[model samples]
Structure formats: structure tokens, C-alpha cells
Target: MDLSEIKGRIREKSNIVDVMAEYIRLQKVGKRYRAICPFHQDTKPSLYIDPEKEMFHCFGCGAGGDVFNFIMLIERLDFMGAMKLLAERAGITIGDIEHKKGD
Candidate 1:
């Protein structure tokens, strides 16, 4: 397993709504979920989640991305750190991936 493989597993195993629910309260709206944007001071539900696309977008503050990006921003972690965190959440081991020459 490499970075791409890890990402794929994370996407496959993690649901956007489920992950977002851990950070904020979500209300189902039509086919998506709505929540107050975590990136800014939001009074109304401005963050929308599209589970089919596995993506989220904030209309009020313009914060948006996939689950990994959300985790990175919300957790204040870099790419690899977010990957490791999400891997653990998805029950995938980072040790399964072969380390690069210098890493």
C-alpha cells in the first residue's frame, strides 16, 4: 500500500457524513447533509455534504474538499499526518504501505 492506495481505502471506508458528524452536528437536507461551517462564524447551515461524491463545501466561508482535506483543516495536520489519522479511523494500518527510500 502506498499513498494512493491508502487514500483509496480511506475513501472507500469513510463516509463524509459519518466523518463530519464527529466534528459537527449535521441535518439531512434532500440528498445531502447541512451543517454550520466550521471554518468561520456561521449562523446558518452553510456547509453541504454530498455523500455520493464524497465531498463537502462551505457556502459561507468557502471551505471545502474531500474527507482528507476536511480532516487536515479541522485537525490542523499536514498531508501525511492526516493520512495516518484517517487510516487509523478506517481501520487500515499505515505499516501496510512500503516506506520510500528516504522516508
Candidate 2:
């Protein structure tokens, strides 16, 4: 699959609330969940998780995205690397883990 296809798959499989909760101290806030941003030093809980959209946004530092984007940003990885990372987390295999996308 291509990068876009991989991103789509990751988005479909990712749960925004769950991924955010893993890295942040999250709390239920009205219809969404809030947490301090992990990408940068944050206070006042500027990170928000919208489970309905399967995405997160950080008002403090502008960090935002579906889980793939989150992983990419957090891990300093490219799109394929992020997909492979999440695929491992989800126990979805795509051939050799060390293989590049088109290799």
C-alpha cells in the first residue's frame, strides 16, 4: 500500500482517546478529553482528544492529528515508519518490519 493508504488504515484503526491517554494524564471534559501536551512542556491541559473524529489537537503548540500523525511527530519518524509502528501495536503484520514501503 501507498503512504495515503497506510495513513487511512492507521486512522481507521486508531482510537484518539486511547492513544492520548497512553502519553498524557487525561480527564473527561464535557464531550471530549483533555490533557497536557506531551510534545512540549504544557500546562492547563491544552491537548484535546475528540474521540468521535479519532483525532487530537493541542492548542498550546499546535500538535494535532489522527494517531499516525501523532506517532510520526512523537517518534520523529516518516509516514511509513509511523504506519509500521502502529501496525505492530495493532498486531497487523505487513511483511518484514525492516522493509521499506516499496522495497
TM-score list, all predictions: 0.90, 0.79
Model 1: which ten-residue window has the lowest total lDDT?
Answer: 94-103
Per residue, candidate 1 scores C-alpha lDDT tens digits across 34-72 of 998889999999999999999999999889999989999
Clashing pairs in 2: none
TM-score of predicted structure 1: 0.90
The lDDT values for all models are 0.88, 0.78
- lDDT score, candidate 2, position 17: 76
Give the top-scoring candidate (TM-score): 1
Top candidate, metric lDDT: 1
- Every model: Cα RMSD to truth: 2.7, 3.8
